[model samples]
Target: MKIKSLITALAAGMVLSTTAVKAEGNAFRCAEGETYYMNVMVSGVEYWFPVYEMFKQAAHSMGCKTAYTGTPEYDVNKQIASFDQVLAKKPAGILVHPMNSDPFIEPINRAVESGVPVVTFAADSPNSKRISYVTSDNNREGAYAADVIAKALGGKGEYGILENPGQDNHDKRVAAFIARMAEKYPDIKLVARAASNQDPTKAYNAVLTMAQAHPDLGALFMPEANSALGAAQAAQELGGKIKVMNADVNGKILDMIKQGQVYGAINPNQGMQGYMGFMLLFLAAHPDLIDPMNDYKRASYNPMGLPVVDNGFAVVTKDNADDFYWDAYLKRRGTKGIEE
Candidate 1:
């Protein structure tokens, strides 16, 4: 709330932190003709495109260049090959968002050991020694989603969660949502938990099957974007028999929200993550001024605080959807704030 107010008046070339964006300061200023290159990594979903576009624009503004690459789907082998390609090019720095937390540890470690000043964004590789992570407080986000659903159901409805059970990020988010609901709302009953494998068709079938089998099911909570999209289709076909709450934003989901066909989404400030990732990498390569790992946090962060930066999320509903009008960077990427 406070942060939104601040952003309303931000001038060009300002870097928005949770607290403030300086008057004359910018995110970073690169040296003339400095070949600062970064690879923006992601495990592709509908959600990753906007983020990469944001990073690319930010790099351009700072007089640097960037390459965007990732596995188009959630394939470990494909992701590894992509990571290797980025490393082989030996960019000034690297920013990777791993598909799974543990499997990518070795590759991330190699990136760091080779002095690549890597930072994880969105989905993180926590076990690996990535410099910093930029993402929403996923647990907090889950709790928030649960709160919304519980209130909507009047605290006493039977519900189910369509989960991507093995992914650490999704697992933690779902767990947080569940724990918060149990702690705060006593009578809400959880009927079932289904793994949707982050597939839209699978989620649609699962939701259709569940709705048919359990006529009493009042709501469905989905934590992955594809599943959420599938659940949207199911909700549409079910003729409003079920209520849904889920994470991430997409063109399809935004339209569903506008039509009151699906519930709101918890959306990460992904553009900011890409913007910050570029800033961190640029700073790491150009400066002996601050130690990328130690000194930077001490200088510009809340010390008695959260370790990772919470870029925060804008809870998008029809009422507030207009607040997130497409920026120039988003338009350049061919996304008109959830337009199909």
Candidate 2:
């Protein structure tokens, strides 16, 4: 596969519409006298703030109100409770990142069954009756990490993984990385797999333990950027031997990549995920405006369409780390071509 772009319009903090949305045209009509509310619900609150920001940007562009509500802790129960609380308001639609697949089915279905559309983002509850799912190709992200790390190590080295085991998307990334390594780079052995649960401190301790046990460990791959805080610190303290690789990018992670403390990152187009997720929810909720055959009642697919949006990803390294920073994205967003 060819190298992905350094930063796409969506990754640059510019709200992008997947397909042309008739936000105000005669083809689309808002619910009369009803204040349409859109919200994003997630578990790892801090890590997803940028995504919520972009979600707000999308809501702003569409002339609607949006809110962010979720648990800071990585607790599924807390997220579920938060979901319930958000549902009580009877918002127009919801965009949620379900922590696990099985636990979210009932709540998502309940929301949909009640006429409030829900779109899952980043992480999905695939079997749930969600109108749509929006995210990057996580399996390919893992495969990308495996390719980069293997090439960095000259195709042979012992590597460890800092995994968020139970989460569906993170698990897919870890499994794909391991499988890609085993299938394509047989000599690059996976020495240790530690459960970090998306916490940096836990990842730090896990890396320290793995380094102590493996000694020959050449690299470490984590599923998300937050864990890089600890993993990068551990690698830095370990005389800079164990290279750190992971998915997602942010201000701090990009700095680590520039300083060579972290190897590289696979950056998903989070802005697209947020913006398009809201779009999906809006479109799903307003099926009255969308119809292949000219009416939601007669259309075979409008509200119940199970569309999965691939927002795409990019591999970030020191060479283009500057492109993925939050500040740079802000500047780019101010530019004419990419502004929301």
Candidate 3:
């Protein structure tokens, strides 16, 4: 009886030990001091705050660390320099929003070659060796904005666009807006196109000039929030004759929407962009975590090669503007907005 009892106790102990080993092996938490980073140009912009908040949240959930780094300026060269500085830290991975696509190819490729994974959000370097791209569908957002503006104008008025010429995503938005207007609403004329370059003063002057040149201009569209501020001010000056719509929203944009100064906005799902971007970077950095039966292993490619991820978007109108307020969101979150 004593021998049988001893054997049973030893078997139970072995089973428990095996279970513990398996648990440890399967755990997804990060190693001590392992960190990931979110990098962008125009780092001080309000648009990036919500994004990094979610990225930080996702990292913390996985017992990992996260940091936000980038240049406050819009210059692509400065952005690349900041990216290189982050790379010098040898972080576990990075999530970057390249200001322009082509200029980032070499730097991104170099990072990937050095075994540091990179995932881009909001913009892309398609020719680079980055593991993944995460963003809303810019074409769809532009087309949708066109439809909204056209419908508001009753389909037979002139409209103009404020552009940021060099950025890939911004260019796509402008192109698709024009194309959609041409394809679906031939009666609506595109009378003016001006390069705002994301400058409020430029957008203000452009909108004012376009409205003057084309007295029948019923609507205006821009690809970003800053330009919208100036555009909306111009529209208000014109006694709100022109409806202003833009791609992204800030607190001021939401206020304008609420006050009927701006028509509406197509807002990207920034939280999802950050969360999924970090996940992609983490997976790319730790390719050994997954071993699905695929050709990636044989081809000497990273198993986590996700080419594009559409994080999705939302249309913000007066009805839902309150729900999108960044200040309200931060207050609910109980954290400093972007300071941490």
Q: What stretches of model 3 exceed 4 Å from their correct place?
A: 1-26
The better candidate by TM-score, 1 or 2, is 2
Which order, best to worst by TM-score?
A: 3, 2, 1
| Residue-level lDDT tens digits of model 3 in 69-187 | 99989899999999999999999999999899999999999999999999999989999999999999999999999999999999999999999987888999899999999999999
The 10 consecutive residues of candidate 1 with the worst lDDT sum are: 298-307
Query: Candidate 2: lDDT of 97?
Result: 87
What is candidate 3's CA lDDT for residue 33?
90
Per-candidate TM equals 0.80, 0.84, 0.93
| Best-fitting candidate, scored by lDDT | 3
Clashes of 1: 0
Displacement of the residue 67 alpha carbon in candidate 3, Å? 0.6
34: Cα error in model 3, Å:
0.6
> Tens digits of per-residue lDDT for model 1 on 160-231?
889986566788889998898789987987877789977889889898888887778888888866787788
Query: What Cα-based lDDT does every candidate model obtain?
Result: 0.73, 0.80, 0.92
